[model samples]
Target: MKLYLQYFSMLVRCQMQYKFSFWMMVVGHFFMSFSLFFSIFFLFSRFGEVDGFTFPEILLCFAVVSMAFSSAECFARGFDVFPRLIKSGDLDRILLRPRSVIFQVLCSNIEFSRLGRFLQALLILIYAVLTSGFAWSFDKIIALFLMLTGGFVTFSALFILYAAFSFFTIDGLEFMNIFTDGAKEFGRYPFSVYGEGILKFLTFGIPLALFQYYPLLYLTGRSDRIGLIFLPLIGFLFLIPCYAFFRFGLRRYQSVGS
Candidate 1:
C-alpha cells in the first residue's frame, strides 16, 4: 500500500507538469460524458417514464453505472492501454520488476481527468437518493455502498480481462467495448427493463446485473429478500476467472518469447 501511494504521488507530479493538457482532458471528459445524462433527460421529458421506472429511479441506475465505469477507467487506465504497452514491448519491463506487475501497471497511469465524470455521477446519485422517495434505512444505505463498491470491482475486472486478452492479439479488439462501455450505456435503465432474456444474460452471463439490477429491486422495495440485498458482493467472485486468465496469458507470452 505504501508503495502504491508513492507511485500515485509520482504519477500526479508527472500530470501536473502538463497543466494545460491535464485540465483540457478533464473538461473534455466532462462535456463528453454529460451527453449520456442529457439523452436520459430528453427521453424522460418525452415519455415521463421508462418501462415502469420513474426518471429518478432510472437516474440512480445511470449514476451508479457511470460512476463505476469512470472509477474503473480512472484507476485501471493502464489496463485500458495494455494493448499499446504490449505493442511497444513496455510490458516486458514491468514483468522484470520486483513488485507485482499488476501493481506496477496500475501505478503507471492514473487518469484523474475521469474524476470529472465521477463528480457528475456523484451529484446525480445524491439527487436520486434525495428525490427518489425512498425512506432511508440501514439496509438500504449498506446496499447503496455495496452497489458502488461492487460496481467498481466488477468494472475493474472487465478492464483486467481486456488487458489479459491483449497479450494474444496485437490488434485492438473493438468487440470488448460491447461489454464494458456498452454495459454502462445500456445500464442507464434498470436491467429488467431490457426484457427477461437480456436480464438473464446480464444476471447469469455478465454479472453486471449483480450490482445494478437485483439490489436495485431491493432498493426500490420491490423485494425484501436479504439475499437480494447482498447479491452485489457476488461481483467480487468475477475476479477469480479474470485473474486466472491473465496468468494464463502471461504464460503464453513467455512461451512465445522463448
Candidate 2:
C-alpha cells in the first residue's frame, strides 16, 4: 500500500508539472462527456420516460455507471495504455520488478484527467438523488455505495481484460470499446430498457445490469426485493474469469520482439 501511495504521489507531481496542460485535458474530458450528457437530456425531453423509467431514475443509473467507469479509467489507465507499454518495452521493466506482474502493470500509469469526468458523474448523481423521489433509508444508502463499488470492480475488470488481450496482439483494439465506452453511453438507461435480450446479456453475460439495473429498481421502489439490492455483489465474481484470462495471456507474452 505504501508503494502504491508513493507511485500515486509521483504521478500527482508529474501531472502538476504542466498545470495548464493538465487543466486543459480536464476541460477537454468534461466536454467530451458533456456531449453524451446532452444526448440523454434530449432523449428525456422528447419521450419523458423510457420503458417505464423516469428521467431521474435513468440519470441515477447513468451516474453510477459513468462514475464507476471514470474511476476505473483513472486507476486502470495503465491497462488502457498497455499497448504503448508493450511497444516501448516498458512492460519488460515491469516484469523485472520484484512484485506481482499484475500489480506492476496496474501501477504503470495514473490519469488525473479522469477526475473531471468523475466530478461530472458525481454532479449528476447528486441531482438524481435529490430529484428522483426515492425515500432514503439506511439499506438504500448501503445499496448505493455497493452499486458504486461493484461498478468500479466490473469496469476495472474490463480494462484488465483489454490489457490482457494486448499480450497476444501488441496493438490497440478499438472493438473492445463496445464493452467499455459503449457501456458508458448506452448505460444511461436501465439495461432492461434496451429490451429483454440485452438485459439478459448484461445480467448473465457481462453482469452490468447486476450492478446498475437490479439495485436501481430497489432504490427507485420499483421492486421491494431486498435481495436485488445485493445483486451488485455478484459483479465481484466477474473478476475471476477476467483474471484467469489475464493469466493465460501473460503466459503467452513473447516479449514483443522475441
Candidate 3:
C-alpha cells in the first residue's frame, strides 16, 4: 500500500510538471463528456422522457455510469494501454518483479486528467439526486455506493480482458471498445432502453446491467424488490473469470522481443 502511494505521488508530480498540458487535457475531457450530457438534454427536450424514465432519472443513470467509467479509466489506465507496455517490453521487466503483476501494472500508469470527467459526473449525480424525487433512505444510499463500486469493478474487468487479449495479438483489440467506451455511451440511458435482447446480454453475458440497470430500478422506486439493491454486488463476481483469462494469457505470453 505504501509503495502504491509512492507511485501515485510520483505520477502526480510528473503530471503536474506540465501544468498547461495537464489542465488542457482535463478541460478537454470535461467538455467531451459535457457534450454527451447535452445529447441527453436535447433528447429530453423533444421527447420529454424515454421509456418511462424522466430526465432526472436518466441523468442519475448517466452520472453513475460516467463516474464509474471515468474512475476505471483513471486507475486502470495501464490495462487500457497494455499493448504499449507489451510493445515496449515493459511487461517483461514487470514480470520479473517480486510484486504482483496486476499490482505492478496498476501502478504503471495513473491518469489524473480523468478526474475532470469524474467531477462532471459527480456534479450531475448530485443534481440528479436532488431533482429525481426519490425519497432518500439509508438503503438507497448504500445501493448508490454499491452501484458506483460495482460499475468500477466491472469496467476494470473489461480493461483486464482487453489486456489479456493483447497477449495473443500484441495489439489492442478495437472491438473491445464496444464494451468499454461503448458501454459509457449506451449507459447514458438505462440498459432497458436499448431493447430486451441487449438488456439480457448485458445482464447475463457482459454483466454491465448487473451494476447498472437493475440497481437503478430499485434506486428509482420503479421496483420494490430489495434484491435489486444487491444486484450490483454480483458484478464483482465477474472479475474472477476475467482475471482467470488474464492468467491464462500470461502463461502463453511471448515477449514482443522489442
Candidate 4:
C-alpha cells in the first residue's frame, strides 16, 4: 500500500507537468460521456418512461454503471494498454521488479481524466437519490455502496481477462469492448428489461447483472428477497478466475526481438 501511494504521488507530479493535456483529456471524456446522458434525456422527453421505468429510475441505473466503468477506467487503464507494454517488452521490467506484476501494472498508469465521467455519474446519482422515489435507508446505502464497489471490481476483472487474451494474440482486441463498453451502455437500463434469458446469461455467465438488475429489483421493491441486495459481492469472485487466467498468459508471454 505504501509503494502504491508513492507511485501515485509520482504519477500525479508527472501529470501536473502537462496540465493542459490532462485537462483537455478530462474535458474530452466529460463530453463523450455526456452524449449517453443526452440520449437518455431525449428518449425520456419523448416517450416518458419505457418498460414501466421512470426517468429518475433509469438515471440511477445509468449512474451506477457509469460510475463503475469510470472508476475502473481511472485505475485499470493499464490493463487496457497491456498489449502495448508487451509489444514494447516493457512488461519485462515489471517482471524484474520485486513488486507484484498486477500492482505494477495498476500503478503504471492512472487516468485522472476519466474522473470527469465519474463526476458526471456522481451528479446524476445525487439527483437519482433525490427523485427516484425509493426511500433511502442504512441498508439501501450499504447496498448501493456495494454495487459501486462490485462494479469496479467486476469491470477490472474483465480488463484482466481481456489482457490475458492479448497474450495469445499479441495484439489488443477491440471486440472485448462489447463486454466493457457495451455493458455500460446497455446497463443504463436494467438488464432484466431485455428478457429472462439475457438476464440469466448476464447474471451467471458474464455476471454483469450481478451489480445491476437483481439488486435493483430489491431496491425498487419489485423483489422481496433481501439476499438479492448482497448479490453484488459475487462480482468479487470473478477476480479469482481472471487472475488465474492472467497468470496462465504470463507463462505463455513471448518477447519480440528488437
Candidate 5:
C-alpha cells in the first residue's frame, strides 16, 4: 500500500506540472458526461416512463453506473490505457518489479480528472435518494453502500478484462467500449426496463444487473427480498474470470521492439 501511494503521489505531481491542462481536461470530461445527462433528460421529457421505470428511478440508475465507472477510471486507469503501456514496452518494466504486476499496473496512472464525473454522479445520487421515496433502513443503506462498492469492482474488472485482451492485440480496442461506456449509458435505466432478454443477459451474462437492477428493486420497495439486496456481491465474482483472462494474455504477450 505504501508503494502504491508513492506511485500515486508521483503521478499526481506529474499532473500538477500541467495544472491548466489538467483542469481543462477535468472540465472537458464534465461536459462530455453532462451530455449524457441531457440525453436522459430529453428522453424523459418526451415520455413519462421507459419500460415502466420513472425518470427519477432512471436517474438513480445512471448515478450508480456513472459513479462506479468514474471510480474505476480514476484508479484502474492504467488498465484502461493498457494498450499504450504495452506498445511503449512499459509492461516489461512493470514485470521486472518485485510487486504484483496487477497492482503496479493499477497504480501506473491515476486520473484525477475523473473526479468531475464523480461529482456529477454524486449530485445525481443525492437527488435520486431524495426523490425515490423509500424510507432508508439500516439494511437498505448497507445494501446501497455495497451496491456502490460492488459496482466499482465490477466495472474495474471489466476495464482489466479489456486490458488483458489488449495484450493479445497489442492495440486499443474500440468495441470494448460497448461494455464499458455503452453499459453506463444504457444502464441509466434498470436493465429490466430494457427487456426480459436484456435483463437476463445482464443478470446471467455480464451480471451488470447484479449491481444495479436487482438491488434497486429492494431499495425502491418494489420487492422485500432481502436476499436480492446483496446481489451486487455477485458482481465481484466476475473479476475472477477477468483476471484469469488477463494472466493468460500476459503469457501470450510478445514484447514490442524496445
Candidate 6:
C-alpha cells in the first residue's frame, strides 16, 4: 500500500508537470462519458422508464458501474497495456526487479486522466442518490459502498485476466473490451434488464451482476434479501483465479528479445 502511494504521488507529479495537457485529457474524458448520460436522459425523457426502472435508478446503476470501471482503468491500466511489456521485452527487466511482479506491473502505469470519468460518475451518483426516491438506511449505505468496492475489484481482475491472455497472443485482445468497456456501457441498466441469459452469464460467468444487479435489488427495495447486500464481496474472490492465470502465463512466457 505504501509503495502504491509512492507510485501514485510520483505519477501525479509527473502528470502535473504538463498541467494543460493533463487537464485537457481530464476534460475530454468527462465530456465523453457525459454523452452516454445524455443518451440515457433522452431515452427516459421520451419513454419515461424502461422495464419498470426509473430514470434515477438507472442513473445510480450507471454511476456505480462507470465509477468502478473508470477507477479500474485508472489504476490497473498497467494490465491493459501489458502487451507492450511483452513486445518490448520490458518484462525481462521487470522480472529482475526485487518487488512482486504483479506489484511492479501495477506500478508501471496509472492513468490519472481517467479520474475525469470518475468525477462525472460521482456527480451523477450524487444526483441519483438525491432523486432515487428510496429512503436511505445504514444497510443501504453499506450496500452502496460494497457495490463500488466489489465492482472495482471485479474490473481490476478482468484487467489482470486480460493481461494474462497477452502471454499467448503477444498483442492486446480487443474482444475483452466486451467485459470491461462493454460492461460499463450496458450496465447503465441493471444486468437483469438485459435478459435471464445475459444476467446468468454475468452472474456466474463474469460476476458483473453479483456487484451491480443483485445488490441493486436490495438498494431499490425490490428485494429485502440481506444476502444481496453482501453479494459484492463475491467479486473479490475473482482475483484469486485471475492472479493464478497471470502466473501461469508468466511461466509460459518467452521473451521477444528486446
TM-score of each: 0.96, 0.96, 0.98, 0.97, 0.96, 0.97
Tens-place lDDT per residue, model 3, 1-258, is 999999999999999999999999999998999999999999999999999999999999999999999999999999999999999999999999999999999999999999999999999999999998899999999999999999999999999999999999999999999999999999999999899999999999999998889999999888989889888888789999999999999999899754
lDDT of 5: 0.89
| Model 5 C-alpha lDDT per residue in residues 125-244, reported as the tens digit of each score | 999889987788899899888889889999999999999989878887899888898898888888886789988988998888899999988887779899988899988899999999
Which numbered prediction scores highest in TM-score against the true structure? 3
Candidate 4 residue spans exceeding 4 A from truth? none
- How does each model score on lDDT? 0.87, 0.89, 0.95, 0.91, 0.89, 0.94
Q: What value of lDDT does candidate 4 attain over all alpha carbons?
A: 0.91
Cα error, residue 183 of model 1, in Å, equals: 1.0
Screening candidate 5 with a backbone cut-off below 3 angstroms (N, C-alpha, C), the clashing residue pairs are none
Error of 4 at 105 (Å): 0.4
lDDT of 4 by residue, 58-147 (tens): 898899999999999899988989999899999999999998999999999888989899998998899998998788888788888888
Per-residue lDDT of model 1, residues 69-180, tens digit only? 8998999999888888787777888888898888888988889988888888988999999999999799899988899899999988888899898878865578988889
Candidate 1, residue 230: Cα displacement in angstroms equals: 1.1
What is the alpha-carbon lDDT of model 6 when measured against the actual structure? 0.94
| CA RMSD of all predictions | 1.7, 1.2, 0.8, 1.0, 1.2, 1.0
Reference-based lDDT, residue 149, model 5: 89
Which candidate leads the pack in lDDT?
3
Off by over 4 Å in 1: 254-258
Please give the distance, in angstroms, between residue 123's alpha carbon in candidate 5 and its true position after superposition: 1.0
Which regions in candidate 6 have their CA more than 4 angstroms from the true location? Answer: none
* Residue-pair clashes per candidate: 0, 0, 0, 0, 0, 0
